[model samples]
Target: MVYREMETDAEMAMFVKCFWMSDSQNDEGIHTVLPDGYFDLIFYRIDNNLNRIFLTGTWTIPVDVPFTKNTSHFGIRFKLIASEYIFRESIERIIDTSTNLPLHYWNVSDETFENLETFSIEMGRIIERFIPDYTEIDRRKFSLMGCLYDNHGDISVAELSERVGWSSRQINRWFNNQFGLPLKTFANILKCHHAYRQIAQGRFIPESAYYDQAHFIKEIKRYTGYTPKELFELKNDRFLQLSTHDNG
Candidate 1:
């Protein structure tokens, strides 16, 4: 089980959220014990086939992204939206795949390996098949999601609609129905996420984490009640970092 985050090709960067690769061993997966509000795109790449597994789940309130825990069911994760979007709504409701139907995950309960494997196979097929409708960039929502991530969660619906060549109102409706939040709210989550990572990766000092160390503190406070020093994980972040036994 190896966890990594890499930069994507510039054109794909905004939506891609850094490609994630997971070679799950007999026992390895990830279950993020996130802060109160969070969302991420877990792009499953199996045997070189790439597809998206979008996860929108909220953290416990107080907005403390306490830690990331990679489970025994090994997998990879691509953090999404920085700090703007909340995952609670999406996890509570089911989002459809191509058909826009509700994705009732409960139908396939734990221990239902057969059904899970079948779905994974089909997902790989969709990525490899690359039919016209499933082209990577064609998924307008992902493109918009990436934009939100890249912009640190400050993009407007109009900008996303224009980029995707869709009507603003139409995109707004779809974005709301699909992601459970207007594009802007989700983007706010990403901004917070980006700031957190900056602090996490040591790129920014605790004193330098706030908006110019002064402005935007209120918004920052909304997500993380304290400054970067309070939330920053010293020693390795307990959750996302992992080592593999079978040479992962």
Candidate 2:
């Protein structure tokens, strides 16, 4: 239930958004819903002279309407990145091309995410360097789909390769260059994300029947170090892990 808008003078044309909690029953995480990651970063344009970004993260349940609100912002998307160089190197890094430490963005603040919020002040100053006209990314490189997200956990590099018309090597390169990780890493991220989403939904049914009776058993086990019953009980921490800069 988080909605944000960038009307600031320096905000980009597109915005970044993250949906941690939602009523979506499709069981798709950010990568499946946005095909990029659990958290989405986008540009925003305004008043013919201003630009900003809508960076966000959110949560969803198992029965919410499909993209009924902001998280599904116009059904937009980004390319998939595995290691998530963004956390290591964010928008400022791209603009400054410097590997300096202490970077905070959107809401990701942690030694894990980016050294906590202590550097927010510095990040604000650095953000000013982003000009109004950076460049438009290729739209074709992304996708948005709320349906079929149920199958995201099973999707592999071979599947994505065919869809993107890329070889496995090329896909790996895309992950490292665009996201800063390898393809397998990204896939593992997605797997864990999907498992967490299902775990969150366990509130609806009997915990015992949920995992064992479902097909997500092994898949969930692979990503997360827990069984379905354990997942339901420990859903909070699992989701917290997902929320902590772990984009699908």
Candidate 3:
């Protein structure tokens, strides 16, 4: 498989993490996708022809996705705030799964997948049209999310609430309603995602947030079904993200 990614600019950074594309080589295979606490809007194709478009909800655990020979995918990975200001709908119903979106949802065409650079620019325009006014975003929610990403989900729920000036009860309720998961679960996913990046870079040690090595191992296994060492080994390309990360 061949994979590539492009980072978003500052203007779109608050709503999008990155734009990525993947191509299945000449053989059918399974791609193990790890949880990164982000949702996606995917445009899938076969033989370079637009097949379909779909929206994915936030993932809490790894999912194995199968691809046919010569298939390709282009996707936009979104932050939490996009649900309110960009997509403007609740994703709670699709948690851990995805639903097919109308092919014309974004007026997507076969031309949109022609190249990553063009796709990235086009998506920025699309997202901007969805939220012409930046103030449509809630200040407290924006601050809370910024802090979470900055700290890699290291802060506690209470501290997050106090920092954002929002109550914990309200925060949890909002999380559950929007993402079908609590704040801590999402935070843990982000924390585990950071650990994956470290492991991919050939670092085997646990992060400082874990109580100890054993605690870190358990948490890694819980979300990724592999200990840090196993993930680092990269046997048979079991983890697709780590396998293609450098290629990206």
lDDT of 2 by residue, 1-248 (tens): 22222222223212322212222233334322212234434332222211334543321211122332223221122222101322333231131121222223343322211211222333433433442233433322332111113344346667666665667787666545654445565554454554554455653232332244454565455444456567566543333433332233
Return model 3's CA RMSD, one decimal. Answer: 1.6
lDDT of each candidate versus the true structure: 0.41, 0.36, 0.85
Return the top candidate by lDDT. Answer: 3
TM-score of each: 0.48, 0.40, 0.95
Candidate 1, residues 111-140, lDDT tens digits: the string is 322233443433333323322234423456
Clashing pairs in 3: none
Better of 2 and 3 by lDDT: 3
lDDT by residue for model 3 (18-47), tens: 999988869787878888989999999888
Off by over 4 Å in 3: 244-248
TM-score, model 2 to reference? 0.40
What clash count goes with each model? 32, 42, 0
lDDT for model 1 comes to: 0.41
**Each model's Cα RMSD:** 9.4, 13.7, 1.6
**Candidate number with the higher TM-score (2 or 3):** 3
